[model samples]
Target chain A: MNIKEISEDRLVIFKDKNTLTIKEHEKLISLMQQIEESMMPILNVNVSYNAVTVQWDIFKMDVNDVKENIQTLIKNLDHIKIETLEKKIVEIPVCYDSEFGIDQDKFDMPIEELIELHTKNEYRVYMLGFLPGFMYLGGLDKRLYKERLDTPRKKIDKGSVGIAGGQTGVYPQNAPGGWNIIGRTPIEMVKEGIPIVRPGNYVKFNSITIDEYRRLNNDKNN
Target chain B: MIRIIKPGMYSSIQDLGRTGVEKFGQSESGAMNFRAMMLSNKMLDNPLSNPVIEMTIVGPEFEVLKDITIAVFGTEKIRLNGSIVSTASFIELKEGDHVKVGRLLDTRGYIAVDGRMNSNHILGSQSVHSQLLDIHPLRKGDVIKIDGANEASLEKKIMSKYPTVKTYKGKPVIRVMIGEDAERVKNLDSFFKESYTIQSDSNRMAIKLSGTKIEADEYDIVSDVTRLGLIQVTKDGNPMVLMNDRQTTGGYLRLGTVAKVDLPILADARLESLVYFEEISIEDARALYNEEMERIQGTYYLP
Candidate 1:
């Protein structure tokens, strides 16, 4: 683990590996909490797979002092008494009908087998981005992995479920995307600022018939 | 209440932003130009956090329903009841009065009423994020409710100091700081010595630029992290300056943040405008930011 200064003195970049485990994510969050408790005017902390960028008010604390404290904390990671984070599981219903799934035929496997493989595994919400309420989930089954489209779609409907590379996630809003779409969820505005499915939360997708989808969809949006 | 006779290019409600929701992948959706918004609110005796109508490209043609003072900010040819009006200053408006704004010189403008806008708030902000609020920009016939008093008081108008963009040889010179991958950037000379032109596709999300390539040692870093005013060097080596509606996180290597003081300048730059990012020390950036906060807080006092 190492701490690198970004953009002069405001943001500190912490990089570990190309990808981080859930525990590493938890550690970074806890470290940020410790810094906040120290009365540092930390504005925001952003974490990718292996990097955590800490944005702060440069005037509040000496940049060098903040860097030193972060280094010391990382060196003594084992001694840090950080509590475990709360885990949440969110259930998502996806409709994989022929009309909604534009690239369904791209997969050679039967739709049922594909759906079965998807539902059996749980995905971890590593981060949410690209669009509001959009989460990038990890833990896709190796057998169901697929590449993105050569030319991206002009507009992908909201609540569209997709798979790209080694990741599987759902789109919260309609926008241009190259991911391979397999289904669409009836949930409109899946999660707003309230953040129903936040980072570190586990997501489970359940397949439903068009009737059930319409029923949930007709319930005036999820 | 106000009625939109013409939607203009784009008009939506926004405040400072919805903070403390990055954990849920929320971007701080706010005014593209904070300085202009702050100044507009201050001049009109309005709360700084009150939601204002953010207009883009072509300004909207609207009518105020009550006797209230309104302020327009940023670079745009605006008229109140067919009369040319100055920006950063409050102009009295009356019932059924027509207010029209023309095409923007900077591609963005702002309209701040003397009070708050009655709109649904999600995540503790009146800001309208498409995903959060599920609403689009203002259109013709849309009614916006404001909380200003019924009677106009011209005495409430106050004056303050604000700076416009400085163009050195016809290019908007933007001051920036170093980014997270500052040490890894191998082409620092090209970044500073060479000027970049803003792309036309630039919007609230980011202002894309194409110029001298400043590729960092690493590009496939991480996804999903805080990036505001970050100048990200994409895999193709183009610089994209993230704005208020930027993603919560990204994977590209960022050069640094554009000083908040200069954000309004960047926002006012016209499409395809040439912009430069001159790096500055963090200490100077802090001092300037503090000065801006002070300027916005109590820019002027009215008797």
Candidate 2:
């Protein structure tokens, strides 16, 4: 729950036991912006949270001058208390059929058990990467942590949800992938400039029967 | 306008890049050699951010369907109408003139037409992230449209000054600053001094290099935000240079980052080219970056 200055210019949230709430993340951003503005001609500010980074170009200023200014700015932020809002739970309908799950055979778990385990807990978006709209979700059940395939598939179908190490995510588009596929989501995670879920957003998988999935797919097509 | 009679290896429309969308997992897709792209743009008096054709190694052969002014930069051997055209020079293309870009003198080339490309500016950038999106590489018979016909005539005489492109000779020495995970690296100083070779499997996302292995400390680092030019040394002792289309976050320990100005040189580097590393202070790194920027802006004067 504390912001630790790693370097004069770099700061990281000390998340050893307490996770950063969404409000805390936003406050950190605003505070960083304030420091950056106050340091105007002195230093540029770059901020990152859950792997998302933003950089401010401070046209040719001394790094030390900016660092000192930021320390002063941080001291003033002591009174600002940011609180987290109620987490929004999005129910993503997923079809656990093997055909949609291209790498289903790689997993030893039964499809029913996998579904039960996946939907049992809510997951947080750590950061998005690898491909557009791809969400790197944390909080996966520890038992499901699997290694990526030795050789990646040339093309993983869009909507295919997969797991690697201790993370799980839905592939927003068809691209080469190494994660082990468990199911396929019907929702489009990204389109144009908008992302389906931003970092800090909570997500939960809701299992759907093959017939239900087909109905939903048909509905989307229409 | 030009017609691609024979599109060699690969070519695509590119500009500076699309930013502010990486949060959605989109890479800041753009021309790998940003300097070359800008040089071509400046030669034609086009907007610095205007789109250009990025041709890769073994570039395409295009037939001029109509008269136009075009500037080429980046690669070494370029020929127009079967006559050699110097790199970073603007030339008038008459109807029926053919342009052929030989095997990349470096690895990529930029040919900037007089105006913007007639293509969709998806996500505010014309540059295509081929690996991330469905856009295919430019191929034969592709009719590229160029805007601003009058601007072609207003073009100034080619600028005499140009950047001296350095190559990775013997053991290519690339300078880098200590990354956030500098403490994780074992023998940080030795790692920067050792020699490495650009592995053949390198690409826009990451450049794998074979060199002295640097192990990380016991504390495991999670996948976090990364930037281009970051040298992430894996557990296997190989160093990977993260590039333009690299993953937004990574877990591997970072040794340092190659100076931003030197990234274009690293981009065009051929496979198996030996590379070395030199650690520099952040202040020195910033200075070098500013110097390159000034040089690009045509404000830096060489003594």
Candidate 3:
């Protein structure tokens, strides 16, 4: 493990490896949670594929002291065995009708085949960024992988499900994105003020009809 | 209460912004010009974190419904009841008074009232992220409610202009500290030697610069948590200074972060404004921060 200082108040803990497996990710998550629980001055902690960034209050502690403490914590992380963390499986209902799929024609397969390929598998939430509640999901069927649009659409509707490269996820908000859209979910991706699926959560997509999408969408609005 | 007669380019209510919430994919949305916001709030005897209306180049026109005292900072083109008034000072307004903030010479301006604004506090912040949250920016004919209006009888005083607030003229030199990938950048010297112009697309999220391509072997990095003033070098070989509304994390090579003391200057830079960069150590940056804070604390005075 290596710790690189971004600034006096922020540093990132990352391994030398290029990518991380699911098991390594769980360990990284445990180490992140431990750091958050132990450091009172830590303001926020965010994790990516194989790294964790720690931001803290500079006024409360010295940079050198914080660095040394993080080093000690890393040494201790190996001796401690962590239990399998509890993860919630969030079921998201999506409408795969060509009417909602703006870019369904981009794929070579038929609309029904596209839906089957999308809904048959479960995906894991690797991280969340780009937009609020927009999950960076892993575990896409290789057949579904496609390159992003060369010229991205100016505006993409919220809850629009799309695939780009090796990832598939839903747009949590209406914004400009480059992902190829296949379908959309009616339910709000962000409930209250928090995202529905967090880092360790699993997401399973359930196919629904266009009429069902409207009904659920209306119910959400009301 | 107040009503917006005309909502200028981009005006939104903001405070010091949210912390400890990046894990939820939330950006730290706040005032771009932190120093100006602090000055306005302090002048009104409000807490430093008090919400203020942040205005862009063009500012809003407000019709005061109740008697209140407000302070406008970082701009000189302000009018009270159709008469020009000095900015960076406390001004008392009675009901039915119309205050207009004209086109600002500075890139941004701030207006702080004496009471709490009645706005949505999602995840403990009044900062409006129209895309992420249900809140929207100020619009024409929108009514704003304040919790305790007409309360503070602030002494009418025209304060001195803060030295850190830069009204852009020539190319301003912004200082920075070493970043994690500074050594990896092949042409790091070009960042300091070349003068860049702020792109028109720049907003609260980031200020994109065009000039002097600072290249590297590769620009992608494992995404990680980002801070307020991080200077991210994109794949296009141009540098963009991450601002208040930057995402929680990004996947680009960071050259360095703008010094805490110099972020106000960056926030006040106008579109197409010339910019230069200089390097500073972390210790020096911290020292400058302390000096700026002391200057602010000692400068808050009344007649």
Candidate 4:
């Protein structure tokens, strides 16, 4: 792994590999976490796919000094003990009934079977981006894989659980999106303007009835 | 207090925007023309990061509910009580005074009040997120609260010391630094030589540029972090400069980043206007940025 100075104040640390695997993604996240703990005047540290971008305040310190410090961290990455992050799995309840399943027909299997297969496995959150609280979950069952909509929906309702190209996640807010919605969740993905989930956390979906969804949603609002 | 009589086109309150939250998928939605926003604040002795009302092509008309001092930048068509006023200095408005902002010469304008304007702080800023359902655009009849000094100081210094009010015109040449993925583009020289047309649909999220097709080996990379001025060439070979409200991560091949000092030029660029990119080294870009900062700070007056 090495770092490239993308700009005067921003640098990206990435592996030379063209393809990104789960192990490589985990390593990138670990590196990002280590960089965050190093008490450098870094403005922000972000990881996506196979790269970790570090930005510093140009007004506060010289870029050359910051770059040298980051270089040292990268060189000693192997010797440094990578902190083990706690594993947290958030259970999200979803109603897969026909009312909320706007694109259930996209799946060839029966609705009940589709729901079972979707909820059967726990998905790893690769990253959180594209939209606020939008978790990019990996590990979707091959049976549920579907291409994104040719024309994205102008607006996808908040709490809509969607699947696209071997990925499943929930929309935190009402926004334009292209994923095929399979169910709707009553729980708010974002609360008090902050997302409930974070990158490196695990997510598991639980099936629920429409009535239950309404009850939980009403309770949340009240 | 200020009451919006007519919210022309689109108007919203914004600050320097949220930081350290992009990792959570939040976009930094700040004022499009940051230099204008800062100048408006500087003229009124307010903090540079204070919230200001950013108006689009057609600006807003409002009534002053209380006496307050304000500075409007990026537009000279400011009228108070049906009389034109020079934007070179702060305008002191009394109760019941009507102010109208006419068609802006540039695509965006900023209005900063003397004191702090009350707004909810979400994710460490008051910048309205364009895609968020909860955040809203200013509407007619909305009254904005302000903790004001009640009277404008008569002995304030002239704002002539500040950068002259800008009205973008002609084919403005925007400077850029080579991007990390510059090698991906086969014909890099074509990017700097061609004149690109600003698309009508361009907004705070990104500026779409249409011109010579600069091909690349791959259209998409593994999704990566993006910066405010980063230029990404899309699948069709057209370049789009990401702006303040851009998604934190994208999958396009980047060509270069617009120099920080030149970002205000692109921000105020009108639709269909022609523009060119001039490449400079990263070191040179930093020097240009530092030079501008020193000039602004050294001459900055607060009264």
Candidate 5:
């Protein structure tokens, strides 16, 4: 694999591929996993779509030395093609009832069609951000697309799934959000105090009855 | 037990933040001005990562229920029973002693108690991410549990010679290490030459930059994990410098990240302050950070 690398003293920047294909992402993920498991005296790793920023703890050793170690590791990994994560589909239960789906009427399509389009295709968890456990899931079908609201709500309930423009995600906690809400999930993201849907996981949304939502919500509160 | 008599503007309990939680989509929510927190911790002979009261703009009013050694780092507006207490100096507090701090000279400050703080941690951190967890921000009438007494039984205190606070006289020049893909950024050659002012939309998550519309050659990029000090330039031509409360991943094209050593300086910068970035080697940044750390650890009273 070819790579373009640069550094600002202790911060190293590496970007080999312009586009982040699944294979390239898998390689980056596997590289990160290898780095995580290494005994290298690194500080933190910030992975972006195609570029990776690495910070090292200089107190432990020399920055150049750490860079050399990373180069060697990358070389060894280049010799072996890394495989993508094992396919694990997390089936999420989304309730699109009027009470839960505040933006049901705001949607362009009928509520039933909206839910059908949403639940049909599985989404790829690209990343998690904005809020803890707030997964930025890819694969939003164009038919269900909607831009964000002009005025953001001061409070979007936790477990509320929202759509903004071409993106869709779950609000892990009750917080201020700008996305258009279409449904609610009873899965408590706070169980582990963080979202468990690690990047690279496939998520399939399943429609559940309002009663089922109530049951799951009741189980969570208790 | 420390009872909060008045929970200042934004005073909250924060440590250095959690680690290895980026996989869970969590930003390491920690103290904004880490240097101030570190100095206070060093003064009390406490581990740098120990929990401390992170007060900002204004400070909190509290009653120390137990005698403890405390170190205040930041502005010199802190007082014990109305008597002014110099920052970076250790003060032995007796039971029932009331501590109050006035508005700070900087945007943020820190108060480090001698012992471990009784705080609730989620995902291996006691730091509060107001948007996600409720474990942060000291509340009124809430009781904070801390070590009953000063752990360092030293007869006297020796303070470090480091400046009590970092003051930005004017638009300061912050060093930046452009990412490898920085060549794809708009105005790459002149981005460093042009100056940018801190935008009002800045926060703990990131500092948005005004004046310069620093865009990238290609805007659409993969959303990836982020860290403190990463500068993400949005499509609107705004460059936001991520901080302690930054999200785990972002989609904006990054120009580069601010050096770790200069993060506190940027954090303490006032809104709309003039700022510039000088391209530097990562080694230079590390040297500066090491030099600063050495200065703080120079005259430690304890091993």
Candidate 6:
């Protein structure tokens, strides 16, 4: 892994052979904070293990000053090591009923097998986008990779778990969608009142029967 | 107070935008043209960051419920009681007076009310992200309440000099900084030098450029935080410049980010206009952005 400064205030950490571990990510965050504190008139720093981009507010300081601070920060990062934090295994209950999974029929595998394949792997949250609380989770089974619908549905119901390419995610709101729907999660990924899963949070799906889902839904209401 | 007799096309409340929430997959949904929005607010003697009504290509029609002062800016031709008014001018509206924004030569327009809009702030922003936030667009029959001094000896005045709205003419040369994944872009020089047309499929989220396509070394790149003015090369090698309402993260290989100052040019670009890329240092980009901001704020005059 090599960290190179692309522009005066921009930096990119290249990860070629080595996959970016959680520890490396943490170290990058701490290093960013340290540089931000020492440097006057805040700098915007963004870090991704695979190919992260960092942009700084060069308006406040001179170009040379920002470059010097970034160079120093990169040099000092060698000593800092990120300590792994405890990983939480969240059990998200999902229903793979045919009606809810509108696009699931397109897949060759049966519903039960699809659910099994989805739940088998611990998915990592690569990034969040498109809508609030929408997690783009990687590490899906390659066999489950499927193309998006030819014509996207006008509205994909909220909490509808879908797959596109090799990624799987849940819709936070009822918006236009093109992903292949595989299941529906009872848990709301994005709550209007409060946020559920943020970026960098690991998620695991636990298959549940319709009966269990009904009981849990009723329990929450009660 | 103003009553929406007819909200032409898409109209919504917008401000500077919500930042620091991009990490949560939240877009920085604000006015597409910050300069226009700020100028409109400035003309009204209102705070630059105050929430204003953003009118699309086809502007909105409003009936003044009460006598108040307002200012209009951007591309649309303004009309008061069916008579055309000059752009970038402040006008006093009397009760029962109807104002219609004519068809826009450009894609967007701004109308800054004298005071703050009566709306709840979500995620520290008043700007409406209708698609994700599930907020309804401003429509006909909707009455929007505003706060400000009543029409007491309000004199209609227009500034003698106004900042010229800069636009990209002919083949636009968009300056950009090389992306972190510049290595992924095969035939990098050809990607920049060749002319690309702004595809009709472009929108606030992304502008798809059509022309000669360049292949990327990798197909599926990990999604990460994307910013405005980012030229993301899609799977088919076409470049899509991400805008204000763009997804917080994406998987496409980024070519580079267009200078912030030049973003408005891209936003207001006519469909099928040819665009070319020019590389600039990060220092030059920041300096130019600051210079433009200063000029808009009247700190410095453009000769």
Q: Scoring model 6 with DockQ, what do you get?
A: 0.43
Worst 10 residues of 5 chain A by lDDT: A1-10
Q: Report the lDDT tens digits of candidate 3 across residue range A1-222.
A: 888777657788888897898888877777788888885589878878778888887878877887788888888878777667776789999998888798999999998889999998878887887777878887899999999999999999988999987779998888898999999999988876688877878899999999999999999999
For each candidate in the order shown, give its overall lDDT on alpha carbons.
0.75, 0.70, 0.83, 0.83, 0.75, 0.73
Give one digit per residue, the lDDT tens place, for model 2 in B62-103: 888888888777665578778887754567788888888877
lDDT of 1: 0.75
Q: For residues B36-106, what per-residue lDDT tens digits would candidate 1 score against the true structure?
A: 77777777667777788898888889888866667787553478788887664577778988988887666
Residue-wise lDDT of candidate 4 within A1-222, one digit each (tens)? 877877767888888876678666777787787778886777778877668888877888787787777777777767766555578899999999888889999898899899999999988888878877878887899989999999999999889999988778898878788999999999988776667886677899999998999999999889
lDDT of 5 by residue, A10-63 (tens): 343455546677666666666666777788775566454554556556678676
TM-score of each: 0.85, 0.85, 0.92, 0.92, 0.87, 0.84
Q: lDDT tens string, model 3, B16-129?
A: 888878888888888887877887887877877789999998899999998778888867658999999877577878899999998988688888988888888888899987
lDDT of 5 at B207: 82
TM-score for the A chain of candidate 5? 0.88
- Model 5 pairs in collision: A8-B281, A8-B282, A9-B281, A9-B282, A9-B283, A10-B282, A10-B283
Which residue runs of candidate 3 sit more than 4 Å off their true CA positions? A110-113, B149-158, B164-170, B298-303
- Candidate 2 interface RMSD to the true structure: 4.8
> How does model 3 score on DockQ?
0.60
| Model 6 docking grade | acceptable
Give candidate 5's total backbone clashes. 7
- Runs of candidate 2 with Cα error greater than 4 angstroms are A1-52, A60-78, A101-111, A147-154, B150-172, B217-220, B299-303
**Which candidate, 2 or 4, has the higher lDDT?**
4
Please list all clashing residue pairs in model 2, or write none if there are none: B172-B274, B172-B275, B172-B276, B213-B237
Residues B1-303, model 5: lDDT tens digits? 689999998888898887776666677789887777887788777787889888767889999887777887667657889898776467888999999988877667788888888889877888987555667588889898886445548444555523433224556778887763477775876678777888777777778888767766676566666667887777787778888887777777878878777788787777777877888776676677787777656654332
* DockQ of predictions, in order shown: 0.46, 0.39, 0.60, 0.68, 0.49, 0.43
Candidate 6: fraction of native contacts reproduced: 0.47
Write model 6 residue lDDT over A94-179, tens digit each, in one string: 88877678887788878788888999988766555667777767689998999888889898997788998877888877888789
Residue B102 local lDDT, model 6 = 68
